[model samples]
Target: VGHTIESTVLALESIAATDNIAKNLGIEAGETIYYVKRIRYIDGKILCLEESYYRQSIVPYLNREIVEQSIFEYLETALQLNIGFSDMYMHVGKLSAESARHLGLTEGDPGLTIETVFHLTNGRPFDYSVITYHYEHSQFVVQANGLYL
Candidate 1:
């Protein structure tokens, strides 16, 4: 699908990390982290809402300008960070009131949620994200190739 995609920054700030987020990133509680929230659009239609937290010590230069583009690209190219891997969990659940409002849906509407933790080449967790896709606009396609015995 060759369609245009856009990201609008809803929020970008540096804040103290919670215990859960700190644990996920292997950092101490109350450590500084960069929080980013964005609403995604595909062909000018709302598509998803994504929120992310990045370890400030690892990504010190994170800013709204950088996030409006691609953080992964910035990390890999500008910062010369080697992205290792990510652990992802996906599920279908009812949207919270805040998430629903952002997506123009009613509270408790069904939506797809994907949570991910991104790691660096040395296996240090760098970023964690939760993305909620609009139920009506969500489509996922995965392809695998391997040698058969």
Candidate 2:
């Protein structure tokens, strides 16, 4: 759980930095990109979600600073939780249409898939990914892509 939290933080930071660089290079509109991080707990397990958006342009003064600040606030809140999990159950990268179908995600739904890469100081780095499809705007169907370490 600790490793997951740490990796999540690093991943978000990297995304924020990348967004800044992209903005400076004019690859993405500075006001159109934003980062979102969400955390949930179920059955004594913690699940973290992070994504970088480039199409939503509904905010004023949208920049890397605002994005990083929001992430920092989220981490501050998550660090207060006590999670009890020794081993993870799912992790992987990329999602194809077939994979989504097998995972029960409908074809027409708006969904977000995350590919998480983790580097540890004493162990091999790994990629963890998840796909979430939402229906009815109330619930999401989740699928894990690879083995959890």
| TM-scores for candidates 1 onward, in order | 0.90, 0.24
Per-residue lDDT for 1-149 in model 2, tens only?
23223212223222332554343323443433344443322332333334433222222123444443443343235433222212223433444565335334545444444443222233322212232422222233567888787
As a whole number from 0 to 100, the lDDT of residue 68 in candidate 1 is 85
Cα-based lDDT for every prediction:
0.91, 0.35
Report the number of the highest-TM-score candidate: 1
Tell me how far the alpha carbon of residue 56 in candidate 1 is from the true structure, in angstroms, after superposition: 1.1
Query: Which of the numbered candidates is closest to the native, going by highest lDDT?
Result: 1
Show the colliding residue pairs in model 1.
none
lDDT of 1 at 66: 86
The Cα error of candidate 2 at residue 110, in Å, is 1.3
